[model samples]
Target chain A: MKSEVNTVNNNISSLAQAKPLASPAVQIDFLNSDDLIKFETKLESSALYPLVSSDIDIFQVNLGKMCNQVCKHCHVDAGPDRKEIMTKETMQLCLDALDSCNISTVDLTGGAPEMNPNFRWFIEELSQRGKHIIVRCNLTIILANNKYHDLPDFFAKHKVEVVSSLPHFSAKRTDSQRGKGVFEKSIEALQMLNAIGYGKADSELRLNLVYNPSGAFLPDDQKGLENEFKRRLKNNFDIDFNELFAITNLPISRFLEYLVDTEKYEDYMQELIDAYNPEAAKGVMCRNTISIGWDGFLYDCDFNQMLDLKVNTASQHIRDFNAEDLHSREIIVNQHCFGCTAGSGSSCGGTTT
Target chain B: MDNSYYDPKDLKKFGNITEWQPKLGEKFFDYYGEVFKEGALTAREKSLIALAVSHAVHCPYCIDAYTSDSLKKGADEEQMMEAIHVAAAIKSGAVLVHGVQMMNKADDITM
Candidate 1:
């Protein structure tokens, strides 16, 4: 026999002759093929969980969908070019919801939200009503144009809790998920908010930064990632804030388009289904928060609002807001729900945990 | 597609990424690394949190990374499955809770 070298060489040659099993890009179809039936079953059966809820009062103010940027993951399909802006009538209805219901917290969201012509006015009205207001701002929007140049002062003035999207502290990754130049402006805007004492530990201004992944991945750890975001922004760009919220991007609108375009749909969905955490399930945001569509239609969250899944209640639009009637109403759900409960749970605010 | 982001077509010019800014890419790389490491929380803990958040934000890349991460870091199949269920609960709950507004709207209509 020859030597051990000859034997090893023969084995290596045979190994090279074999075909590859699958590439990482689309491995699900190749290896996880057997999961198709179970995947479909789970997808259809998301709401069978034990954590259903029916008590909530706040009427989240979805003022409009016209945002300054068309983020790749935006569910509302809102952007600067959008002509559909919230009307004064819708604003009034939101205020009415605050006044009529025992709703104490009013979550205000929109495209850039600050880009809304009546955004400040709406905040003023809600503040006047002594409601806990949360304005979801795309940080970059605060500094992108002169019209919104004064947003920091405006938010702080109303004592509004600002939930701004940062995605990442680094520019390239952030810009990759958002558009070009967005990361820099976001950092700058965050700095402005920090200067105004929004995210500071003891500050009451309450500037919470939101982070979604740059690609089709889960957001990294929230507390640690927040510390890092705080450290980096503080070191690199001199920005500061209170908390760093790590949010999972909902698979709808532009993000759904991205998944289909990049061919990451099935694997990603399977990953979510495979990684469902029961602890995460208990903290799901939909149970506590209400999302209103731009047109006053109701949705469980912004993602469903984008998919046009209005509440399945007798009153679906803003023209009919009654806290008690909704207290016992059953929520309508579909496959997209798996996206929410798949992991730690996601919401407009961030991780439910 | 013609944006300034790292397009794969431009993978060959990895050296040129820093031409625009000398240390930005590597800096991002470092921060990116630090973010994914074990924390006061273990890697397993971090992975589970990431997995849960992936559903909340709904990033497929995140779902892919955290699924593998959780499994590798000792998350059993059931544990992982349970995490997604948590997300489902919150998501559906979020959708259903808004029914309050609808109920209020309906109450105003009927009552």
Candidate 2:
């Protein structure tokens, strides 16, 4: 009877908090539900439900680390500050790896991968081979250069799966992480992509949003957050996308700096360790997705690539790219593994679960 | 917005969580060491859960670490394998338990 009274009180308080009656656009803040089940209920019903995915087979190429913005959590130290760019010969090495590996997909990434002069040429080659092409875009880069002006239509034409970053739906949060005015430019770039049918729900040209956490903490539940993101973004910015990928920020480079600066190094480490749900150990991205750096060196994943932790095999570079060699190759990992095991695991592709 | 407490994206400043909090960092280091020992749930098992938790609680650091850990622990095969099955079971179970609320709602309607 006492419990029942408590439940009644909760219901009454909730009712009182329910829609201000003045605002129809929102019933309540989407993820404020103390009830996890309510959140999941919304997730299963979301339009951007992570399509059960296995890696699209392919040797992905890290074109370069020449980005336009300096995101706080970037493990690559990628920014206008980074000068490393992929060479044409290195690009050719990628093609060679693709040919040797018979990879069906060819993922292209970088600081602002579009900044690579050969970016278009490489995509054109991949498209010619009828490979599923994936391009990681910073989004703002599209507007940063005239040469990139038609990236949306170009991506659509080639049917490239464009995974672009938009850290948060709100301008304030986004700008804080990615630099001033970047949010506006990202939105514009997204609109351009949408106009070309890149992110339309049913369109073949896929445009997915990439989310990195602004601070040291892990991202929220992807399904619930994605639903809220879809709703808020669709309603607020007139933007449309197929999915929102919640990627983890690895502890390396600038982020490592953040850890030290914030003195969150220990707690964050403990969080991952304490939250080390053994379940995440099985399906991490690096297990299936092999990362190739700009110079054709093979690493288990992009973070490994940055740490210069090349795959432990006789054949390291793309020129020596071999599926048989990689078949049982031990992926190199260290203390950072806690990050992935700590939460719903994160990876280059996004959240593991 | 980025700390352990609360992040009101609804509010502009997620609050100034001073640049450093040494205590949490120390705590993390100690637990991290404990979690990594052999048979301490093995980093591999933790990886799969970390991935799922990445989706659950949403920490990017945990996600990155586990993704790498899972792969390193001879988890090179497609994650769609048995390990993924485990995560699927847990994640689905987690979501489904909340269905009790929906059932309660239905029960309320009936009564």
Candidate 3:
């Protein structure tokens, strides 16, 4: 099985870059073209229209778009070919913004945030500020090269909450969605994290794993899946993690391409519509978390950041950093927003309801 | 509406039987939901049983729903295939066991 990364060597751009889908306007148009009820109307019926932030508690920053693998369902369409990376100046701007706000958590995400040159510096700066740091570490990166081999040790030292994606406990299922050999590497990376008290019972180092469906389906009950994951990982490989976050794959970027190509787009949208839960809608992560793009522009959530939907406020950039304006601004929504509100609801922290 | 006897789309309407026969439909659905919950048998185990039963009954909709249900419940390929084989074994055994009846009839009719 060839790694999906090989596509980069063949000179393939991300789905966004290769087609008219690169334009946010086109994606938004495609989402709205569906005959299903509008997302805002559903919110209105639930009395959640004009959804405004409760408060900004988590500041999620995209470090870059360079990754070791090209996952089939990646909403970012991120890969090795992506050259958009946040510079040190942008990192400084983020730090400055954090200073002005009482936001307690900083979430670092990317194609692979560790791929950024300033990633360590940014983490160090955040650590020094006593902010709760969460790194969305793709486990394979810890073993991708010699330089990254020490990542587990570095993460332990900083007490950075290490949340990694391992789609399934089975190798075939996991690799099918992520890549050919991701499961094995992830297991090895997890063992390394476990060896240094990362996910241990007595350790303060928090390690969590993220699980999404391997195909066009919603994930099973998070608690049940976590139990299954714990049993299988412990019996099969002796790995341990604190919690499992079951996330619904929002239709955007490469995943949107997959849905369109496989002709499951309409059916999937209908599934999401049928599973819509109003309780989940009210707790949608976008209401409490703000997403910052690689270059410092802000959005309602990471999915919005990928689709280029800037936050609806005067302080649309990190440099502006107005908590009051952000708190009162209406969140941007379209058909894709349904993914987050479906069933138990999905957020970076797992089910919102 | 089309020529085919089955439409995958109909699976989504499984809940709508209540519109016409509300009381019985509601009762049946409540029973069905209760039957599949975690009991002495884990939901995962029940899902595998459902997959096997789907095959024995030859219900395409059940086959489709239970297969996804089994996977979602974390039943792997080997476990799923083994469950179907359980159904197959019982189905074949039912046919083979009737050979005793055929033998008895032959013995009674023979000279």
Candidate 4:
């Protein structure tokens, strides 16, 4: 397999493979593809139905795929060239659904959720409804534009929970995965966030840092890694944050290409398989979350959303959302689900165990 | 027969040592496990020390194992590299300090 680094010349052409197929008829195969199906069957033998949604507590919206930076492990293959941005109509649909469903959290994600032109309007609506809003910020977005400089203050004003991905506290590891000068900008963004009492004690403005492994390895214990991050960030830069979330990299999009390019796909898959925990599987995020694409299409979770695997229901769009049917829908699982069940387990918020 | 001195394949078979000699291999494994267990220092600290020593001895296998071990134990790349530098500095000093012995022998023989 060839590396897509050179081919991705800041355009949509780069995402020829990374883009999710329009229809479910296309079969996506990774290294040892059969293992995913067999693993699901193995769970059934143990009387465990691991892939089923219990309730819909989170309404995760992918604002679009227009990001400033093109990360190597980005599952969405989001970059500047991608033109898909959620419009005002879709935002209204999301707001209506949230109002009717009484969802607890409205997770806003994107190439950069803030990149969307209607980001402020969408958040204002969500906040007006008294819904807890979580922005899956990419850190660099805070410093990407001059207009975005006031976002930390904006977030604090709205009492929004910010979950930013900071792969590692160290500049070398972080820049290698993100981009050159990214660590500096991210640190600056973090400092700006801290100044507004985001991560400060007794402050309602909650700030969380996310840690994804730079390579094809599982993250360390969340509590231990959080302590280490807090110590290092504080001792080195006088920066403080709330908590660290360790998310396992699912095999999809550019990460899948990377696994194939490095020839570690089979080994990595086996590692996830051998480390499967039923306890972890029980608490998989898909059980309580519904992911909405930029176009208002619905998915079981973020990974399934990336894979273009729509929910296994006739009402596959948020415009047609029925809480009763969606809550009881069987989660559409595949080999990628193993990434969530391995070892300590992983989710958008943090570790399951 | 495989002619290479170090079969890249054998590294993957480290856990299969008991297949050759079950009794002594098991004993050695037990002792190795005990040596790595936490006492005063943490398993993380021990892994860092192991990573430093692995570089000093120039054993690729040990270096690979300890690098992964150290990362898994929550040691960052910065600390791991620092440990390696410590090993490198000490190894170089050991070689340089031995020049005193060489000088003493030369003086005794020549004088």
Q: Model 4, range B1-111, lDDT digits (tens) per residue?
A: 687677666777897988899999999989999988877876778889999999999888888888877776568888999999999999999999999999999999995
Candidate scoring better on lDDT of 1 and 2? 1
What local lDDT score does residue A221 receive in model 3, on the 0 to 100 scale? 84
lDDT of 4 by residue, A32-54 (tens): 34534465674685566657788
| Best model number under TM-score | 3
User: Candidate 1 docking: what grade?
Assistant: incorrect
| DockQ, every prediction | 0.02, 0.02, 0.60, 0.46
Where does the lowest 10-residue lDDT sum fall in candidate 1 chain B? B5-14
Better of 2 and 4 by TM-score: 4
Candidate 1 vs candidate 4, lDDT winner: 4
For candidate 2, give the DockQ: 0.02
Determine which window of 10 residues in candidate 3 chain A has minimal summed lDDT.
A1-10
Weakest ten-residue segment in model 4 chain A by summed lDDT: A18-27
Give TM per candidate: 0.68, 0.65, 0.93, 0.90
- Candidate 4 runs further than 4 Å off: A1-13, A16-27, A31-37, B20-43, B72-76, B96-111
Best of the candidates, DockQ: 3
lDDT of 1 at A33: 42
Point out where model 3 deviates above 4 Å: A1-17, B97-111
How much of the true A–B contact set does each candidate keep? Answer: 0.00, 0.00, 0.40, 0.30
Clashes of 4: 0
Q: For model 2, how does the per-residue alpha-carbon lDDT over A1-353 read when each residue is reduced to its tens digit?
A: 11222222221211133413212112122112222223122223433122122343546678888777767666666766456799988888777767776668777888778888888888998898889999989999889989889988888889999998888877776876677799899999999888888788778888888877766677656665566578778998988888888876665655655665566656565555555544565566666677888777888778778777788778887777777777756666555555665568776566776
